[model samples]
Target: MTTPTAPLILFDDDHYMYVFEDQASAEAGWEMPDEFTVGFDAPARPLSMTGEPLDVRLALAGEVPEEAELRRLVADHCRGHLRGQVPPQATALADFVAALPREGR
Candidate 1:
């Protein structure tokens, strides 16, 4: 089978997050088995100059119906995914964005 593309990385002053190609492959979707668990020995290092720990999270979108809808979908999915994983109180917001296009970077 062909390998999947690397996921996108988006960082805020406070955290580092990742976005999958589609919602089904993301944590918000049902595709992952219930037994799944992240295995990182240490928390992700922050890309910010401050050198803080990154609070990584995921986002999903099956297929946005419109351009405006894509933003809402990403926001909603990210919010839910970050809830208990990050802090008791958290909201979705973009800070620094980076992604690899289909063409070679």
Candidate 2:
């Protein structure tokens, strides 16, 4: 008897379910970063494109930092890569920081 193999799970939001298909299709659809560990979320989280309240997932590669530390790290990364100015997004780091419900800021 042959042993059954567990399904592979790849996590790009758009391609999340592509694992059910063949390897080529899965490879073509897999585009999420290889790094990152899920950490941090927003207060009074916003709705998704489907208009459903969605939990915001933020991640950082190895060595996930504490909230305050993460904030500083993100500031540095953005300043360096964004040329000291980040492009506008519906939700942003500053917005997330300010939106925190506690005195951590």
Candidate 3:
């Protein structure tokens, strides 16, 4: 098991944030990139064996995301992952977001 690189790459889609080692791994194993859970901060960041900039790309992907970014990602994930009936996690996220004071409203 080789050590993962510091400056990783992230591929963010509608639902999940995929972690990659490099541009090549990101491109080759795009179909099955390592899934990153939004909002929840892990002890260590996810490492991908295989590996750029598409939807919402992050340069320092190894570092934790900011609060606003987390909220945005969570919202997007909930929106895309939700279907038929709303999942418990999605409902929780919605309630959490709703409780937060907005700028105007």
What's the lDDT for candidate 3?
0.37
Lowest lDDT 10-residue stretch of candidate 3: 36-45
TM-score of each candidate structure, all chains considered together: 0.22, 0.28, 0.29
- Candidate 2 clash pair list: none
- Positional deviation of residue 53's Cα in model 3 after best superposition, in angstroms: 15
CA deviation > 4 Å runs, candidate 2: 1-33, 43-65, 86-95, 98-105
Model 1 lDDT tens row, 2-97: 222234323232332344443223334223232222211011111111111332333222222232332333344356655533221222222212
RMSD of 3: 12.0
Off by over 4 Å in 3: 1-12, 17-65, 84-105
Clash numbers, per candidate: 0, 0, 3
- Residues 1-105, model 2: lDDT tens digits: 121111212223322111212223323433333422222222212111111123222222233224454354444445654466642333555464443222211
Residue-level lDDT tens digits of model 3 in 16-45? 544343434444444433342232222123
Worst 10 residues of 1 by lDDT: 39-48
Clashes of 2: 0
